[model samples]
Target: MTRELDLVVVGSLNVDLTAAVRRHPQPGETVSATALSTSAGGKGANQAVAAARLGARTALVGRVGADAHGEDLLTALRADGVETAHTLRDESESTGTALISVASSGENSIIVSAAANARLSPDDIARARPLLASARVVSVVLEVPVETVCAAARAALESGARLALNLSPVVDLPAEVLAAADPLIVNEHEAREILQRNGSQLPDGEVAHAEALRAIGARSAVVTFGARGSAVAEPGRAERVPGVPTEAVDTTGAGDAFAAAVAWRLSRGDSLPEAARWATRVGARSVQHPGAQPSYPTLQQVLDEPGLPV
Candidate 1:
């Protein structure tokens, strides 16, 4: 029998091409760069690897191309103990790629060439139903087709698994699936864009935004304010958790790290507040390193967090 997974992530998979620059370029301006590098990425894959490395029995259900990039991606996930049995290889499209520029301050700007990631359809979601249904938590990012995301969400809901949705590179979410997300994860910018596009009554502060996020559709919501920390909302109350103080080297995958930590803690039976606290510690640690997957800390490392928030 296939072992049940702690978290099953269904979305995109990609290879990342990155460069370190002094700062982000302004409109119509160019800047010198240093240290070009490549790695396995894509929000879905990043979150899966992060959770797996942290000892979650994690699986990835996404698509890549039938090429070298796809092979490398599989190797990376397997190295981190992420189950890739459900990850598919598409003969029609090339593997996805992301062009990333990281400034010295750890902030990054990314441009994605979606390729095979864009081709992950609802049909693909159906193929992974058993894996999705057996997971304790099913998480997804807005990298693949939105319909595919909805299919995964519906499957998880039907199976009574907790659903965590990250609306990154934000897009309009279907009402049914959006409401099914137990904790709708969005960074501050993504949150604002989603609310505004959906014509949600925009709230003023982080706490209020989190509350508003819950009001919209999510059973619970978390609005992350980078450096400042994050605010979470459940039924009875809402509160803010301060960020772990750190000097960051690169902010790539920080939000993915946060989402994975939340899912991992939830799978371990931690409450929202408790989960957010641990997530903050993990996110802060990610910014101290350079890539997405490489920056993630092990479960033991998180346990040894010196300044983890209470």
Candidate 2:
């Protein structure tokens, strides 16, 4: 029998082409970039790497194209100790790519061409059913088809695995899938957009936003507020956790690190708030470097950094 996985990530994998700019281009405007770099990325792949770096036995379930970029992504994941047994390759489409522009302020804007990621289907999830069943936590992201994410959630639920849904680039998810999310993670903007889409009243504060999300469907909710830390809400409780202070060099992929950390900690039986606290610290560490996967801190790096909690 296959050893149970600590975390299973069902999502997208992409090669990130990043450019450093003085500022983001205005609408329909062109700008010169100072430098350009290439790295492995994709929400699914990033989460798997982040969790593995943090000492979780993680696996990835997604698709890449039959190309060099796809091979590079697989290499990066394997280097980080993530199992890629379920990561497939499609010949019809090119590998997914993300065009990222990082401004001098460390904030970034990204445009993704999903390519083979778009080909991931419910069948992919079904093929990975055994891996999902053996995971303590299964994380799903929205970079792929929503139906595929829903299928992963259902499989996780049926297998009694905790579901951690990172609802970035938010979309309308079914109530059942939302409910399965032990903690549905989203940034402040995403949290508001979700409420707006559901035709619900906007909450006045971040903590309120988390509570509103829990009220909507998620078993719990987390509203990340960048450097301010995150707001966490669960049954009969809601609170904010402050971020660890760090000099951010690049903000890209920090959110993926946060989501991965939360799921990994949850698999270890940490309470939702405690997990979010640790996740916040991990996120802070990621910003101290450049790129997505390259910037993620290992467990030692995170623990070595000056922080209240280990």
In the range 1-310, model 2's lDDT, one tens digit per residue, is 3437899999999999999999999999999999999999999999999999999999999999999999989988898889988999898989999999999999999999999999999999999999999999999999999899999999999998999999988999899999888899999999989999888888798899999999898999999999999999999889999887778889999999999999999999899999998999899999989999999989999898886475
lDDT per residue for candidate 1 within 118-226, as digits (tens), equals 9898888888889888899999999898888888899898888999999887888788888988899999888888888888867888899999888888899988998
TM-score, per-candidate, Cα-based: 0.97, 0.98
Identify the leading candidate in terms of TM-score.
2
lDDT of each: 0.90, 0.93
Candidate 1 global lDDT? 0.90
* Worst ten in a row by lDDT for model 1: 301-310
